[model samples]
Target: MATTGAVPMITLNNGVEIPQLGFGVFQIPPEDTKEATLVALREGYRHIDTAEMYGNEREVGEAVRESGIDRDKIFVTSKLNNGYHAPEAAAKAFEDTLSALDIGHLDLFLMHWPLTDGGYVDAWKAMEEMLQGGRVRAIGVSNFKQHHLNRLFAETTVVPAVNQIEIHPYLAQDDMRDFDREHQIATEAWSPIAQGKVLDDAVIERIARRTGKSPAQVVLRWHIQRGDIVFPKSVTPERVRDNFAIFDFELSDADMSDITALDRAERTGPDPDVFDYIPS
Candidate 1:
């Protein structure tokens, strides 16, 4: 009874469906990523999220091929590197990502960060062009705030397919999620468990005991019940399997509320508006 069945799918604005729960390779090293990804795939994860910034897209791709799962059957997503925010660089980076992953095409591509310099506007335009060429099924933004999305709406032609942001029990991001919902953009929650920061919370622990699930499971279920796409990352096999088991259970309204109430605007990552680091 670990997993009830297949994971749920969230349809993007452009009609692409992404698995509600996936495996994320953010801090996972290149050497270890392939096996880690394979383990998650073996444990029933159909979606795998990697990025140029993550420096492990190739390993993720290797796992997909080695998993023996059809490319179309598995959903893959990557991002344009932060340094490659210019229109031309963004276009080139997209090709490099596809080449590095050696995947035929990407299910989703994102502007990894909305740098303060405003280059994302043109980079997004380039992504829209890439989408037209059929290299990427849908284009999106990650770590973007409300005003950043507003700028895109004012000047861009296509609405983003999804917004991947930092969301955990401590940072519910209700306003940002609401904005994405209003615009028909699906919200994907990265750092869903706050990088182990929330596992020790009293409320989350209490609920975990009541549900007979792990603390991470309770927090992840809270995100699912809130209707956000969540991908929890772990190199450990047992944790990876445990994370995907959330689909088998439900968190009552009161439980969901208790977790939601823990939100205090805490963020484990940098604030999107001013975080301008470009990976070297």
Candidate 2:
């Protein structure tokens, strides 16, 4: 039996504990999501992050059920799609996610994106209601900048348990991460490797060689050392196994700083404040 202690846990502001390292299912085609997720579970990943936008929640749920792990042993996270930011739509979307995942309750649910024009405050209200209703253990926001989070703070009574964002060596998002820490909101890094863009950098390559770890492992260890929750996506079985193997090593303080200095404010995803387009 795989113990839940394989990965460290970060307690959220609301007292919900989540695995610091998890599996992300983004851009993974729905057809293959099940097998990939099952592989992750078998590899000892207790947390699984997926979103409605990814169109693979059902398959993720299937993987969970078929993995034969106890429901309480795995932590599952899903997000609201952009088009469903309205309060009513948000409520329905939550139910739909539950039905699709068939997990009975969600471990953590987040707003996929802060659609500024889409009444996110109201959507958050519905999320609060979801939490109060006992369907979700924790609620949070994704791709929300400091200002976006400030708006939620002003308009809502519940503080988000997390703020999932695009974070990699190239785009460290230091200021936003600091804000989340100050507010006791856990930060989750989505593209922790910058979609493989930073794996080939000279500095990262040097650290990888010195640590005798792959570039991917070095970068992921950086996120872990910085105390950010990260979920790297990979459909390939070997890569998935490799990603979960990051817990054994430690990076030197200088190596950590060297990687941190690689932040160039580059982003592989859209800026939250300016991104409002919903796919049609």
Candidate 3:
């Protein structure tokens, strides 16, 4: 279900239709984000993904505000930094995020990474409070595996609405996708193009050649056809627009299988399950 100019929405667990294909500015320099995000907006991307750790929420917000697009028409997602795991600290973190973005209510708020400090329960509780307070429209987890999600589910009745993870052909994560499907949680793909690693794959290249699309577009199209909400980040305005141009084409069944066959369990980002993250 490719969303044309119709905002390309995906129904979130909370009944919010998030754009299935969105723009991401991860790792973009903070100083360069405003112009980049504004370029994305002009290119017809209605959804934007950012994080407190990214240190560019203000720039994203500034770009959104300057775009002159109606607030209701755009969906923005931000994550809580690892340092704010305490329940009491969660509220402050959200407030800080809102202040940085200068937005009224968050479309989605997620735990950036499940830190080893064991503030997740407190963090979840704080997110619940914010949800109730109308500060965040929905709550979710990021980079969390089944164990972390299970731990959270065991403590809270409100299941996470979404799980944003590093997903691409190299790391398909079928188990995680199955878990989300059974639990009614939406799986969002970060680094949906495998950080461009799969571009040179023989299978991926074949599909791209057959489909008349770039390898990146072919991979992103595979993610979307596989029922994953993908946010592929690019700083170049032309690339940003080109990334969103996947809607016009569809991958055949053979193309889908060939792309899926490229899964190698390879992961590009840090594994949230085990990482000695020391906050700066």
Q: Rank the candidates by lDDT, best first.
A: 2, 1, 3
Per-model lDDT: 0.91, 0.92, 0.87
Model 2 alpha-carbon miss at residue 210, Å: 0.9
Superior candidate under TM-score, 2 versus 3? 2
Candidate 2 wrongly placed segments (more than 4 Å): 1-4
Stretches > 4 Å off in candidate 1: 1-4
TM-score of each: 0.97, 0.97, 0.96
Write candidate 1's Cα lDDT for 48-104 as tens digits. Answer: 999999899999999998999888988999999889988889889999999999979
Clashes of each: 0, 0, 0
Candidate 3: where is the Cα deviation over 4 Å?
A: 1-7
- Which residue pairs overlap in candidate 2's backbone? none
Following a full C-alpha superposition, what root-mean-square deviation does model 2 have from the true structure? 2.0
Residue 48 in model 1: lDDT = 93
State the weakest 10-residue window (summed lDDT) of model 1: 1-10
Candidate 1: give the clashing pairs.
none
- lDDT (C-alpha) at residue 174 in model 2: 94
